[model samples]
Target: MFRPAASIAGLITPSPYTQFARAAYCHGTNTWSCEEACAANSDFRVYVTGGDDSDTPDFFVGYWPTGNAAIVAHEGTDPLQLLSLNSAIQAHTGFLGAHSRSAGVVLSAVQKVISEHNVTEVITVGHSLGMLHTIAGC
Candidate 1:
């Protein structure tokens, strides 16, 4: 179960980056690698997480190479702006298990990133439970 705050509407707009997934196979396992995506597309790279339920948080920043050049997730817990993934994950909430604190921490970290990087524009995106999380962060 997830609930989104109305503040989300002021954060970001729905875009293609909402569905972008950056992953790679390693040790016979699939890994959603944010660093790899950042390295590949630094200008439009971002991060994601799982929502309260099974739905994972989509993007919180620039779009993927194949998607539009718009920001998807503009909430405080944006994964793209943060320098530390662990810290971002620790800020999240509204979830069970390991991802509970992800939203909060990610939001804080992204705020820092925006300030540090001087990012003026961004987008927020999510689906199902993730959408709620995105809204709350905004």
Candidate 2:
């Protein structure tokens, strides 16, 4: 989510990017609502949004100008995806869906934001279940 540089920012006494990760699981997220839920970073402009059903990964990317960083936020295991991931693990395939989802998409988005905005930092945040996908870039 890319918020304009002029947007007001909040005081984050905790991990500076905590709210970004939590935005996807916002209470009203079932309806795809997160703007107000992420009021602290309300200025963020959602650049990319994807995922819902079992086979896909749920994630959002946006830029926070105030922080001079691009933010990638991902939802934890959606109950449906969780089951599928577990099945893959049990099958010994070691396929975690990262290839089909993050490798290209995430790298492309991050690169775009970095080059276009010349952002000084790139931060990726998410709950434990989804954090594994972050390693896809490796």
Candidate 3:
């Protein structure tokens, strides 16, 4: 169900990182495509990419975007302020006595792909706050 980052990135237009993620990962799919089958049903999206076997270590790339949210189910996850390093760190560490919810979803998607696809490695790609989440997940 992976759609190659280039195809689904438009769901969030003007995101320069989308292009970067696509190029770096070379393969990915939107949340909707990976949702049911991949077990990523979170309101927020954690694009999953991994289907090529030409590479030495077959792996998956989990992509997270900064400042994009459609669900406010988690407390303290403000779309407007997610750009701040503090907020991104807090979200990654689950500072609100709980995570921003999307954090779990994103992590879950990463795990799902790794486990389901027998991935040997995982590359997390993003910009700004996304970089924080990516490092934190590792």
Listed per model in order, the count of residue pairs whose N, CA or C atoms clash below 3 Å is: 22, 8, 0
All candidates: TM-score: 0.39, 0.68, 0.34
Order the candidates by lDDT, highest first: 2, 1, 3
Model 1 alpha-carbon drift over 4 Å, by segment: 1-15, 21-43, 46-100
Considering summed lDDT, which 10 consecutive residues are worst modelled in model 1? 21-30
Candidate 2 lDDT over residue span 28-134, tens digit each: 43333666457767656666767653455577777777788888776666565344544435621333664366556767878888888899888877776556555
Query: What lDDT does model 2 reach?
Result: 0.63
Model 3: per-residue lDDT, tens digit, 1-138? 123546565665533334433333222343334323223322334444332222111123443233232111111123564466564353323332222434556566656655555555444444443344445434
Q: Judge candidate 1 at residue 115 and give its lDDT.
A: 62
Better of 1 and 2 by lDDT: 2
Winner by lDDT between candidate 3 and candidate 1 = 1
Whole-model lDDT for model 3 versus the true structure?
A: 0.37
What tens-digit string does per-residue lDDT give for candidate 1 at 1-115? 2224447662464223332322211111113345543344444544433233223333343333343333344222344544774644653343443234565656664565566
* lDDT winner, 2 or 3: 2
Q: Rank the candidates by TM-score, best first.
A: 2, 1, 3
| Predicted structure 2, TM vs. truth | 0.68
Ranked by TM-score, the better of candidates 2 and 3 is: 2
